[model samples]
Target: MKHLFLTALLAVAMPAWADAVDTLKRFVQEVRSGQAAFTQTVTSPDGAKKRVTQGRFEFARPGRFRFEYDKPFEQLIVADGQKVWLYDPDLHQVTVRAMDQALGATPAALLAGGSLEKDFRLAPAEASDGLQWVEAVPRDKDSQFRTVRVGFRDQALAALEILDNFGQKSVLQFSQVQSNVAVPAERFRFTPPAGADVLEQ
Candidate 1:
């Protein structure tokens, strides 16, 4: 009877575990465009410091996306298929890098790039907080992140948690998610202000 009960328990749990992986695969393959409001919290390695920022993000697959940070400060990150742009309004600086070099094995690549299986080792993570989770570890040995976990609520993306090599953790909670919807092409395009210092990498 004990063995039978254990088998039954595993049977019930297996599909849910599979759902987490399937959900991520479906999201990557089917959801071509998405926009959302997000709250990002970054915690220090020592747990002594925390910073929170709110932002809006829009992405169209195959290497195009934009993140606009609106609260606590103004910052922007944009990728336009060819290059990635990071803009700091207060500092009047814009940093540019080739899109391929900028996104390798990063969380942005996982969400907004193609070829998921090529970049990361993905697996179902223990679900928690009413969400199914999938954890992805970069296959690249030099990736700055230790692991990236995406959480889904009812098969919709709800959260992303990233742990970096330095032990800092960042959690992004998404709201007002609109998936597979048309996002403007202009959202992914970036032009630095006239006076901003442009640095290329």
Candidate 2:
């Protein structure tokens, strides 16, 4: 759980420009569920290397997602609509928080039924790497990220670049994104392991 709040916020982004808005609406209506493999690189705002984590993710819309970290550490974050459970296997600890508190104005809430115009000040960015990009700055003063960029390839979500307040950036690139796929119900259901410490925030 390197950056728990920050990780929860890497959900989505969109700008009000015609093309960007169209892309967001199309995704909201069609790409309701997905699973993908990801490579995430975290760097200092000054371009210094922090760490890299690779993992697979499975998510369902309207507020359900799970992240499984497999490299550099083993951890998991699961949201069962109402609550979010973060498990740090190496520490034998689990942290739980209500969905509203955990997601705030993060990208997770955006993809899970939030509207860009309502929650973020979206700005269109010049297209790059065959993807249309939008920068999102949260309307909430207390958001975990300073700004986030969402990239879409042909209206399909491709990656997220998150800049935390302290000048650290984490980039998550998704590949093998399968939409409308079946993800087992139990994926978002978490039970703390025996002897693990549980902290409720």
Candidate 3:
């Protein structure tokens, strides 16, 4: 009976792992070709939810992406397939950092060239309310976010929950994700607003 249980566990896990890898690869491939728009609703740890943020997310090969947020706050975050730029119009400040360095705590890194199996290990997760879950833990203890939990529906990423090092949790639920759409090259370009203070991270 113990052996049967173990076999059953492995049976579930192995297929899930393969599915994750394949899903990631397909997602990345589509993203690299500049396809996919992500809309997310962010909820505070206290359960208070903010207005939904809608954006057309575009990705290019090697590590480039643009997340354009429209609603409540208009902000642009772009990683030039290399360095990352986070510009906040409200604060009038732009933060720049190495793309690879910033992927430590976020799930975006999973698609940005960081190998999930290498940097973190994953396991088959639970399903509730029709959402399938996958949990990933960083191999490096010093990493910012302790764990990343991704929820999928029909192989599409439905949500992501991030648990940061400071114990702060941010939950983002996605909707209307369109894959394989053509995204323009200009979407990723950034010219800091006239007086915005640019800070390097």
Q: Report clash pairs, candidate 1.
A: none
**Residues 166-200, candidate 1, lDDT per residue (tens digit)?**
99999999999999999989889898899899999
Of 1 and 3, the candidate ranking higher by lDDT: 1
lDDT of 3 by residue, 1-201 (tens): 000011455657665544544555465455554444555655555666544676666666566677788775798888776678999988999999887787653577764445656677666555655765667778877887777777667778666777777656666666666555566777767778898999987
lDDT, each prediction: 0.86, 0.78, 0.65
Ranking by TM-score: 1, 2, 3
Tens digit of per-residue lDDT, candidate 2, span 115-183: 566668776666788887777788888788888888888777888888888999888999998889999
RMSD of each: 5.5, 6.9, 5.2
Q: Looking at model 2, which ten-residue stretch has the lowest summed lDDT?
A: 1-10
Q: Output the worst ten-in-a-row residue range by lDDT, candidate 3.
A: 1-10
- In model 3, pairs of residues that clash are 63-81, 64-81
| Candidate 2: Cα lDDT at 132 | 76
Compute the lDDT of residue 23 as modeled in candidate 3: 56
